[model samples]
Structure formats: C-alpha cells, structure tokens
Target: MRYSPNHKLETKEKLLESSSVSAKKSGFATVGVDGLMKAIGLSGGAFYSHFSSKDELFAAIVERELCQSLARLGGHGEQDCARLERCLKHYLSMAHVEQPESGCALPALGAEIARSDILVRQQAEIWICRLQESWARILDSDSLAWAILSQCIGALVVARMLATADIQRTVLQSSQEEIGRQIAGRQQAICK
Candidate 1:
C-alpha cells in the first residue's frame, strides 16, 4: 500500500524524532532501528524506505540533535551576548543535568558523539563552530571564548555523574559561579 508523499515524510520525521530522544537518553549506539520503529508504531521494513542505512539515519539524527541543542541560543543581537551567557549558565545548571531530555545534546550524548562516525563528528564540529560564534560576541578574546566554552562543557559532563541532587546542585552552582567570576575578571582586565 502506497502512502501519500506527505505521509511518508511524516513517518520519516516520527522515526527521526523518536530515535533522537532515545539516543539522547540511552546513547546513540544503544538505540536499535527496529526498536525505535516499534516504539513509533512502525516496522523495520518501513525503516529502510525512509533511511538508506543506519549511518544515514545517524547523520540525520545528529543534525536533529544539533539543532535541538542550539535552539536555546536565540538570535544574535546587541543583547544576545548577555542572553547567550545566561542561556549557557541555565543549560549547565543542575536543573538541566536532572532533566536529560530537555537539555543540550552534549551532556546527554557527548561521549556517544565522540564514538560516532565521521559524519556525526563533522556535524558536531559545525555545531561547535556556530556556538563559538555566538559566544564570541560576549567575550573579548578568542582564547577567552574557548576557555569559557570548554569550562561549560567540562562542568556539565562532570555534574552529570554526581550521585545525589544536592551534590549535583553544588557542583553546578560552584562551577557556574566560578566561571562567572572569571568572566568578570577578564572583562575588567579588558577595560584596563
């Protein structure tokens, strides 16, 4: 039975959406196509109709994940720099760590991205560059931008591993406050 082109596209989107969420939660390598399709009320046969191979689907999922990861960055403007800092602070907080599904793909799937294929790596690089561009606006120097970005990534990665809510919150608060204080110092240095 042939479905309309729209229906076919919708089915494909459903597959991508489901797979992305599952990958973010359980790691990309662990989410099987068959299982994902089954969860979305489709069969393995239909999976091929939408995707050439798992690698192709993974690239698509990575792109989707990347978009989701950056959606909170908002538009760049005169005020965007401040907004971006707050957005990053919010993202790296304990609230985000406690809720994986709603946060950036990095904390949820960074390790998996490291292990993924070249295509996924390329996609991740594109996302990172875009983020750097966003971050560069608020920061004065390239080195400062890289430093803050790395600190945010590392803090989130470490914060996610703590066993208790209090410990996790403490980690997030300390890391964020320390980063903020450093940014303040750097900004002051830039003016002097």
Candidate 2:
C-alpha cells in the first residue's frame, strides 16, 4: 500500500489531537503510549513512528493545547475590556469546569505539567506567557493580567476538586465577580 506525501504528518496530527483530549480527561502521566495510540485506532508499535518517547508526546501536547487555548480565549487582538469579560465568563463557567476533555488544558493538567521534565515545563511556560500577554494587552495592565489568569485557573481547579455542584458554582461565581470588579476598578483608574 502507498500513502500520500502528507500521510505521516496527518497521522501525527491525529495522534496529537487524540492524545491531547485523553491527557486533559486523564492526566498525561496516567495515559500510557499504547492507550493513546489505541484511542486513535492505531497500533501501539506505531506510536514510536510518531513520537520518540512519551515525554516528547507530552511536550507536543502541551504546545498544541496551549495554542488552541490562546486562540480560543485570547480574543485575537481584541483590546477592549469586553474581550476580557467574555474570556472570564466562558473560562469560569460550569461547562468549562465539568468538561475536561474539551476545556482548557491548564486547569486540567497544570500540576502534571509543573512536575514534568524541563522540556515539557518550558513548553508550558512559553504558552502560559502568551496567554498572560493576551490578557495583559486587553486589560492594559500586565499585573492585572497575571492576577486574573491566576484567579481563573485557580477557581477552575478548586471548583473541579469539590464534589458538589453548588460549591463549584459558588467558587466560579465569586472569582468571576471579584475579577470583574478588579478589572473595572483598573479601567476606571486608567480613565482618571
């Protein structure tokens, strides 16, 4: 059988996509290479053809996930406060908290990434900075961006940790309101 010139690239992309979802749904360290390959209908042996090792796959996943996240929540050059508000609302919503497979990778896999090897950690740091920069540009304050990003990620983590829906909602709602107030206060001060 003959494969197209882009077949290898396409297969790798499919693997990355499938692995990313699995990693977000279950921690990267918990999902073995065989399981990830099987998720995409590929044999375990074929995994080595795509990635040199599990750590390499993990680093790739971090890069891909963070890029997708930034594009989704970064507002794409939007400088208005409304962009920030929308990002916060969507990021802090129950849907995002409950759906790990399709939601932001940070809250889903942040701790694992932190404990990962230098390569994986570096990839995460690079993408996280891009996310923070997007928020900073929108809010017109670097410090505000860091604060908001930290709060949103932390809220999502805490909300997911709790067993009850009510407590989760409370955490998300409170963070959203408090972060909104802080952004508004910053905007007001800038206008003064």
TM-score (C-alpha) between model 1 and the true structure: 0.90
Name the Cα RMSD for model 2: 1.0
Per-residue lDDT of candidate 1, residues 123-160 (tens digit):
98898777666666667666767787777777887888
- Clash pairs (backbone) in predicted model 2: none
Cα TM-score per model: 0.90, 0.96
Q: Count the backbone clashes (under 3 Å) in each candidate.
A: 0, 0
**lDDT tens digits, residue span 1-192, model 2:** 999999999999999999889889888888787898888888999999989999999899999999998888787784578767987898999999889899999999999999999989999999999989988887888999999999999999999999999999999999999998998998898899
lDDT of 2: 0.90
Off by over 4 Å in 2: none
**Candidate 1 whole-model C-alpha lDDT, 0 to 1:** 0.76
Each candidate's lDDT (Cα)?
0.76, 0.90
Task: Give the clashing pairs for model 1.
Answer: none
